[model samples]
Target: MSAPTEPSRTSDAPGRGPDPRAERSRAAALAAARDLLIEQGWSAVTHVAVAARSGVGRTTLYRHWPDASGLVRDVIAERISTAHTPPTGVLRDDLIRELDGLRRLLHDPVSDRGLRAVIERAGVDPVFARLKEALYREGSRVFRTVLDAAKARGELAADLDPDLAVDQLAGPLMYRRLLAGRAVTAEYVERVVDDFLAAHAPT
Candidate 1:
């Protein structure tokens, strides 16, 4: 193996940073890291390797990511945060749309595999775990916005806990993606939406 390369600060290319060049560099590094994770698994990713793969220098990779774990965490956050925002009139419709979006994300050949690896690593890595928590908090915030709209429209049970409902809505998808490694199809998304609606429809 080659000696670990020096650290350099590169612009984020994929909108991960503010500057255009930084954004571009950041995007390039993320894409390279994502590919490595999917192709070689998390264990195979390193700052030097990512730099080499991204056509960036080790210094640049290090400047952006303190370590391999940090790089992976940022990559996951960047990818998940940019997912499509779903909208539907009814609770069921909204949920189905959200779940379907998640399913499509999880089924993506490159991103899915890379995300799975990152999640697995997050289980044992404290820094990654914290990053994961922050990402989920942001995700929940997005979901809560929709739930609040549904509540205003009287589409959800008046007494239902929005947080719990969000959990219920996402729990199955997480289970399938993380543990079962099962396919998240349109049918599956619809089924989950229907089940939640039946159990929590406005009374």
Candidate 2:
């Protein structure tokens, strides 16, 4: 008789706890894909090569991600979803806090570099552009919500267009980040908040 056969490994197996090894492999694959995108642009990223770089198997990667674009979408969402919502007390205070958060994010080397690369890639890739637009829309909605709250509280000019106001408030920060590559310092945030409030406050 043949020797007793070992149980086949599967997603549901007795005595098998959560697969920490597989989790690490997936994380490594995502990290490798992100690093490759940052270093070599999206055109050079490949699932097989990402697995090799990540020390994972091609089958493992394919098991986790249906395609390279899907993997990239996950990576982008993971990286960019860290944006925090500003508090909702006062309009000026909220804007100041939001700008401070922006400053912190802008100064982070990995995030800053990744954002610039993604933004540049968005110009050429429609999918990336759509992702960027979605991110912007979400952020804009948060700011508009805060502004609407402020309006209800009689803190802002009654006739202020929330969308346009958000644009004015955030445009300078984006310009500095994307064009000048300047650090978003506390003083910079304070100055912008002051200028914005002065211009938009109820008279």
How do all models score by TM-score?
0.75, 0.78
Candidate 1 to truth, TM: 0.75
> Residue-wise lDDT of candidate 1 within 1-203, one digit each (tens)?
11122222333245554565665777788788888877887766798888888887887777767778777766565566535465656666767776676677777765576556657767888966776666567657656777788878887777889878878888898788878978777888888878888887788
Clashing pairs in 2: none
User: Where is model 2 poorest over a 10-residue stretch in terms of lDDT?
Assistant: 1-10
User: Candidate 2's residue-wise lDDT over 1-203, tens digit each?
Assistant: 11111211243256877466766776788789888877876655688779879988888777667567656755666666546565657777788777676677667654565567567778877766776776677656667778888888888898999878877877788889879877677888889878888888898
Question: Which candidate comes out best when scored by TM-score?
Answer: 2
Where's the lowest-lDDT run of ten residues in candidate 1?
A: 1-10
3: Cα error in model 1, Å: 28
Q: Model 1, 136: alpha-carbon shift in Å?
A: 1.2
lDDT of 1: 0.71
The lDDT of each candidate is: 0.71, 0.71
